[model samples]
Target: METTALSQDEVLSLIVSQLAAYGFSQLAQTVAEVTGAMVELAPSSRLSELLYLGKEQDESEELEPTEFPTEEDQDEPMEGSTDSYSKYLDFDIETKPIPRPFPDYTQLYYTQHKGPCRCAAFSADGKYAATGSHDTSLKVLDVAKMKNRSGDAGDKPVIRTLYDHVATVNDLSFHPNGLVLASCSDDQSIKLFDLSKPGVKRAFRYLQDTHIVRSICFHPSGDFILAGTDDNSVRIYDVKTFQCYTTPPTTADLHRGGITQVRYSSTGALFATSSADGSVKVWDGVSGKCVRSIENAHAGAPVSSVRVSRNGKYVLSAGRDSFIKLWDVGSGRELVRYEGAMHSRESLQAAFTHNEDFVLMGDENSYTVLCWDTRTGALVKKIQGMLLFIIQLRW
Candidate 1:
C-alpha cells in the first residue's frame, strides 16, 4: 500500500465494476461514458472465489426498525388528511352535461389500418365500438376513451386490433348483448369475437361462406345473425348451432343483383334488405319469408342502404340515384323523398336522427352530410368536409 498508487482510469474502472456488480448496469454505463473509462469486470472465477470465500459462515442479515410506520399501521389514512378526490369516486353519466360543439367536432378518429375503413358499429350501450377496414383488419375500441379533435385527451381509443380476414372487411355488427362482435368480409368469411375475454387474438367462431359477404347484422335477441352476400342471397345463421338457413329460392321474388345491406327492425319482427337490383324487401323475422317488396324502388338505380325506423312503422332507404326515400312498412309506398345528396357509386348509408325528427345521409361526391326534415322532405343542413365512403350510420 505504501509503494502502490492507483491511476485515475483504474479508480474509475473499479467504481464502474462495483456499480455493475450491484446490478446498476445503467449507472455503470453512464459513468463509463462520462469519464471515458473502460469498464471490464473481474473474471468470474476469481471474483466469485474472493467475494464468497470467507462469507459462508456469516450470519443472515436482519433489518433494524426505522421511524417509518409498518405496513399494518399505514393501512389507515393519516390524521387530518382530506380526500380531495372524493368527488371523482362515482360518476353519474345521466347528470353530466353533454358537450355541444357549434361547428361539429370529431369524437373519435383512428388511422391504424393500412387501407380505407369500410364500416363501424357501436354496441347497444354505446360503451364499445368495432370497425372494419379494407386492409383486412378489425379494431375494437373503447368508446369511453375516444379522443377528441385536439388529439390530446384519451389518445389510445383502440383497445384491440384483430386480423383474421384475408380480404377487405365489409361490415361489423355488435350483438344486442354488446359483448360479442360479428364481422363479415369480402374474403367469404364471417367471424365472431367475444370482447369479454381478454387477450383474444382470433375469432371464437369462424364461418366460411360460398360467396363474399357484404353485410351482416345480429338479431335483436342475439340468437341469430343475418347476412347478405354478393351472390344476391340472404341467409340466417343460428348462433347456438351454427346452422345456416338460406332463403327459399323464388325466381320471381329473389333479388337479381348483389345484396348490399341487411338490417332488423327495432321490434325484431321484420327485417329489411336493399339490393343492387334497385329494390327493397321486408321479410318476416320469424318465418324468414319475404312479405313486402318495393320493386324498382330507386327508379332502376341500386338501393344502397336501408334502415328500419325505431317504431317499425317506416323504413328509410338510400339509393345511388341520390335520393333518400321514406317508405311505409305497412302500405309498401314511398312516404317522403329527401334529395340533394350526391351518391352515385358507393353504397352510402342514411340514418334517422333523434326521435326520427330529421333524416341524414352522407354525400359521397362532395364528402358532405345532408340533413332533411322527415315530415317536409326539405333539406335542412349540409355538413361539409366529412369523410368519404360512408357505408353505415346510426343515431
Candidate 2:
C-alpha cells in the first residue's frame, strides 16, 4: 500500500478546523496564531454589534448571544431549489458572506529563487510534490518535511531539480504507481523521471513530437500518456516505445483555437477536454469518440480548465469569463453557475472538495482565495494571503 505523510502545518490546520467546528473560537484563534493563519469570522459577521447591548456586558454574555435570522433566511425556499449557487460572476450586490474557517490552505515558495511555479503535480503516494517554473526547470519536494524556510540545509522544501526542459515547464503528471513522473514544457518535449534510479533522472527516451503541450495525464495503467496541445489535438504515446500509438485528434483545427486542458474521470472510463472554443467534451479514452459535449460552456471566453468530481457524477469547469459551471455528467446538462465571490482577471483554476460540499478557487483579480457553498451559491469565505502572483494552486 502507498503511504503519504502529513506535514506539520496540515496537522495544525486540521486541529484549528476541528476547534472552529466545535465553536471554540478563542481556541481556534490561538491555534491560528501558532500556525500563522488567523482563524477569524467573516468580516460581515463582525460588521455590527447589538446596539441594544450595554457596554458593561461581560465577555461570557457576548459569547452565548443567539444568532439573529439573516434577511434572506426569512424568505421561502424556491419551488424546486432550497438554495442558490447558480448566479453569474458579478459583485455589484452588497450582501453578508457566511463564515468559513478552512486552515488547510497555504502558499509555498523558495526563499532563494522565489520561483514562479507555473504548474505542479503531486505524486500518487502523496509523498512528493513537483513544481515547474519559468526558470526552465522542475523541482521535487519532500512533502512530509515542508516547513517554514529558514535558509538552512534542511529548511528548504525542495529535494531535487531536473534540468531537461529548455523553456518554461508547463505541466506535470505522475504515473498512478508513483514510480515515474512526466513533465512537459514550452520547448515541446515531454520528459519522464525514473524515481527508482540511484540518482534522480529522466527516462532514457523522451517524447519529442508535440506542439507546446499545455496539459498531460497518464493512462491509469501507467503505460500510455495523453497530452493536450496548442495545435488543438490530443495525442496518446507509449511510455516505453516513445512512439505515438494513435492518430493525434485535433479539436482546434475547426475553429476551437487550442486545447486548454484534458482530465480523465476518476474511474478512467471517460476523459474530458476543454478548449479555447468555449466547449467541454467528454470522450472515450481508447476509442477517441466524443461521449458528451457542452457547447458554449462559457460562451464568452475559452474554458481554461476542467475537473470531474471524485464520484464522477459532476463536471466542473472554469473559464476566461470569470465563471465556473457545474454539470451533471450523465445528461450533459448545466446544473449550476458558481459565481459567488470570484472576480479573477487571471486564468481561473478550481477544484471540488473531497466531499463536493464546497468549491475553492484562485481569485487572481482580487488577490485572495474564495470558497463557495455548493448548495447555496454564496461566497462564505475570503481567505487572506500576501502573494503578488499565485502562479499555481493545488488541492
Candidate 3:
C-alpha cells in the first residue's frame, strides 16, 4: 500500500472545511499547528494569502462563518449587543426552563362587577389597581393585600372606592404622582378624582361634551391630560387649570372617523392617536400639529388601542382585525405584524411593559393576557385568568 502525501492546496481545503463544520475554536487550534510548520520551512511566505484561500474554500462549501468575539471586543461590548457572553450573537439560542404549572387562579378573590370591566389602571406605587366597568362604576382594589393574601383560600380585595359614572367607564389612568385618578366614560366626560382626600366631595370631576370618551392618558410629566372620543377628535386639557388647553378640531380633518386611542410619547414631545377611520396619526404634543399619518393602518377595523414603548422607539396598535401592528416612531413605518388567538374585531387593549421589552394585550373573550417579545414579535408568556384589561403600574 502506497501512502500519498496531500498537496498544500488540498491540505488547506480540508482544514477550511473542518473549520466551517466544527467552528472557530477547533479551527484556530488546527490552523496554528499547520501554519507553524509552514512558517518554519518558508518564513517569508504570505500566511494571509493562505488564510484567504481557506475562506474561499469554505464559501464554496456553503458554510457560514463562525462569529466569535475577540478579546478586546469582548471587553467593550458592541452597540446593541446583549451583555451576556452566551448571547454574543443573535443566532445563539437560549432555552428557558419550563415554567411550573399555574396554581388555581380561580381561587384568587376577584370581584365580578355588573358589566364588562373594559379598562384598568394601577397607581404609581402598585398599592392600588382600578378597573372601569360597563356597570357605570370604577372599582379600586388594594393590590398590595391581594398579593399577600393570594395564598388565602377566600381572601378578597378591599374596595378602595366605588366611584360612579353616568355611563360605562371606558378607560382609566392614575396620574404619575399617584394622587389623582382619571376615568373616561360613555357619558362623554373625563372625571378627575383626588384620592388623597377622604370624602367624595374632594374628588374633582371634569366634563367634555364630545361624543363618548373612548380612551384617556396623562402626559408623562403629569402636566396635561389627553383623551380620545367618538367625536373624531382628540382633546388636550391642562392639569392645573382643569380646562381645555388645546381644544379639539385642532386637527379634526386628520381623523375622519371616531378616535379610539390616544397616547403620549415617553419623552412628552409627541403623541399618537388611532381612529375608526382606518388610520393612525402621530402628532406634535406641544405645537398641536400632525407629524405623520398612517392610512389603512388596521384595514377597515377601528384601532382600539395605541401604546408607545418606553424608549420612544416603537408604537403598537391593536384593532378589530385580530392583528397587532408595530411601527417605528421616527419614520412612521410599519415594522412588524403580530397575530394571536386573543386579538379580535371586538375592542382589544395593548400596552408596553415597564421595561418596554414585552407587550401585554387582552380582549373580551381572552382568558389570559398575552405577553409578546417586542423585538421579535414572538409570544413570550401568558398570564392565565379571565383578564378584562391591563395597565402598567404607574411609575
**RMSD of candidates 1 onward, in order:** 25.7, 17.0, 18.8
TM-score of 3: 0.67
Provide the global lDDT of candidate 3 against the true structure. Answer: 0.66
TM-score of each: 0.70, 0.68, 0.67
- Taken over the whole model, the C-alpha lDDT of each candidate is 0.75, 0.66, 0.66
Clashing pairs counted in every model: 0, 2, 1
Candidate 3 on 227-261: residue-level lDDT in tens? Answer: 88887767888877777744335554468888888
- The true-versus-predicted C-alpha distance at residue 114 of model 1, in Å, is 1.5
Q: Residue 369 in model 1: shift from native, Å?
A: 1.5
Candidate 2, superposed: residue stretches over 4 Å from native: 1-115, 147-152, 201-203, 245-255, 340-345
Please tell me which predicted candidate would have the highest lDDT against the true structure: 1
Clashing pairs in 1: none
Please give the range of 10 consecutive residues that has the lowest summed lDDT in model 2. Answer: 43-52
After superposing candidate 1 on the true structure, give the runs of residues whose Cα lies further than 4 Å from its correct spot: 1-112, 147-155, 387-389
lDDT value, candidate 1, whole model: 0.75
User: Clashing pairs in model 2?
Assistant: 84-376, 85-377
**Model 2, position 253: C-alpha lDDT score:** 24
